[model samples]
Target: MDNVISVILGGGRGTRLYPLTKERSKPAVPLAGKYRIIDIPISNCLNSYLNKIYVLTQFNSASLHRHITRAYKFDNFSKGFIEILAANQTIESMDWYQGTADAVRQNLRFFNQPNIDLVLILSGDQLYRMNYQEIIKEHIRTGAEVTVSAIPAERTQAEHLGILKVDEQGRIIDFSEKPKDEKIIDAFSVSPSVFDRHGIKAGDRTLLASMGIYIFNLDVLNTILKETRKSDFGKEIIPDIIKKRRVCAYFFDGYWEDIGTIKSFYEANLKLGSPSPSFDLYDEKAPIYTNPLFLPGSLINSCKISHSIISDGCFINDAEIQNCVIGIRSIIGKNTRIQNSIIMGADYYESASHIRANRFKKIPNIGIGDNSCIEGAIIDKNVHIGENVTIKNANNIEQLDAENYMIRDHIVIVPKGSVIPSNTAI
Candidate 1:
């Protein structure tokens, strides 16, 4: 892996995951109580022994930059470094990153170094544990110029992903970028024997969808980017090169979920608190890495908690939490009942003086106050919910944009640094 370099694309304007992406970038969104979304890919690279990494960021990247700087610090002897390549305005290109391909093209000078043989492209906002060495070795063995990591996806799931048709040798022959037409999607389906050959169970998932992961030969990538003005890899670059270059599919039958939208993000987090989660966070061998906050264990005072993940430095007093992910430094007051929700906790604890001042000013303290009921919602970081607050969507409205919260796909999302006063209802 010495000759390999990894580039993680921090997505542009995460509109689907808005409110969460309102202040921070998509990659900086908190996940499973403790870790950030970007931590998943960076930890995968470090575990795979691919140390040299560059994260491409464009929109609302301050928090993401801070987390990366604090979490990853390598010694001088290891020759491993994780660098951030933020979008810049230069003489060559003055506009922002038009798409993923454009983002890479703008930063090609860094990746086009002599020591780097292959450039591994990854999405920053995905949840998965992958040994990237396996894909790189397969790329070398097959002599493929480009290799895309693919996963078996069902028909309903295929409409939102880049679907590919592969030959017997696993070479991608035909490609479609998020085709909504059922006829086109059905034509791209793979045979059951293909799944059997790979030892993956072929249930209803017959189509091989791209996981938005790619490996490209240094020379081929430079040549392709120089020849075309294609702005995206999935929608333009990958589909265009499939007919001309040696593009192959690397099948991955692992637990991978793209946290792109509110509905997907909500479900993915709740699943982590399940009895048996598909994405494991307890694997010691390939452990996920994050910032080390030297905080004390949670102080639970007669709280009834079931099937939940409560992070460090939390203080819950007589609260009933079930099927939820409570983040770091969270404070749940007495008689609060939280179910099927995510409470992203505060960054800094409010001192007694600060709390007194907040009370003087008629503002709720920086955590969940007493006598609150929250369900089917995502409470972002540093949110203040006062006593007698009810956050459940009683009307079952699918979409809404209010002053304090926004509802998308029937899940109410309280934006970061928001405040809901006493006796409030949603």
Candidate 2:
């Protein structure tokens, strides 16, 4: 691990997760009421003792840059640091990162260090806890030039993921990126014995889907990037390299979800409120790290809350919240009922003077107002929901884009800093 470096790809625009990605990069999106999406990967790296890291991004990176700078800092004694490498134009190339492979290609000069022997490539928008040293050790033992971490996924899950075909020696012989054709997917399915060898239950999940996690030998990474014009790792690099390089598959049967869409993001957040979540946040040995705000404890006044996670500095007065994730600095007024939603709490508390001014202007405060009903929605950071506002999509519309909100996959999303007037209904 001492000779390894980690690079988290945060370059995607995350169009599927729009509204959330409207102001910040995908990795900077808030998760589980407290931590950012980028924290998961960086925490995994730190826990694995692989500390030298670089985060590559291009779109809406101001918040991402700030969060990284504030959260991850190393003492001068240790050679551990986390740096953000935004897309830039050099004399050699004048374009932004075209794809994942191209993002790494553009930043090769930084990764081409003498002490770095192995490069770990990871996706920033995933929810998982992995000790990367296991994969690194396997890569070394198998003498694999490129190792891809794969998980057993069922047919429905494999259709959206990069499916792989592996030999008996665990070498990936073929790969397909999001193949919709049933024949192609079936051709890549692994046998039940494969799962047995890894001590995992097969259950209907016969195909091995790529987790978009990779461990590459530094020399091979340099050679491939220099020789090819491929832009993406899954769509181009991995598929092309399998025929020429020793690309192996490291089976990981853990809880992992690619938070790529509005629905997936909503469901993943709600899952955390369950009694036993698949992705554990209570693991002291491998705890997730985030910025410390030093906020006061929540003030709950007779609120009927159940199966919910309320963060720090919340003031809930006579509200009913169930199966929801209430973020930091949230305020819920009286008679409000919120269920199956994610309220990304405010960044700053409104001063008394500001609250009075807002009252004079007949504007709602920076939180849920009294007599509101919000269900199956994501109210982004710093949103102001006026009194008597109902946000439930009663019509069951699958997709819609309105002035203040948008519905995708049947979950309403109120973008950051939005204001919903009193008595508004959706």
> What's each prediction's clash count?
0, 0
lDDT of each: 0.95, 0.94
Question: Which digits, one per residue and each the tens of the lDDT, describe model 1 over residues 136-238?
Answer: 9989988999999999999998768889999988999999988899899879989998888888997999899999999999999999999999899999999
The alpha-carbon lDDT assigned to residue 84 of candidate 1 equals 98
1-426, model 2: which lDDT tens digit per residue?
779989999958889899899999999999999999999999999999999999998999999999999998999999998999999889999999999999999999999898789999999999999999999988998999999999999999876889999998889999988889999988998988878887889799989999999999999999999999999998999999999999999989999999978888999999999999999999999999998889999999988999889999999999999999999999999999999999999999999998999899988999999999999999999998999999999999999999999999999999999999999998
lDDT of 1: 0.95
Q: After superposition, how far is residue 206 of candidate 2 from its true place, in Å?
A: 0.5
In model 2, residue pairs whose N, Cα or C atoms come closer than 3 Å (at least 3 residues apart or on different chains), thus clashing, are: none
Runs with alpha carbons beyond 4 Å of true place in candidate 2: none
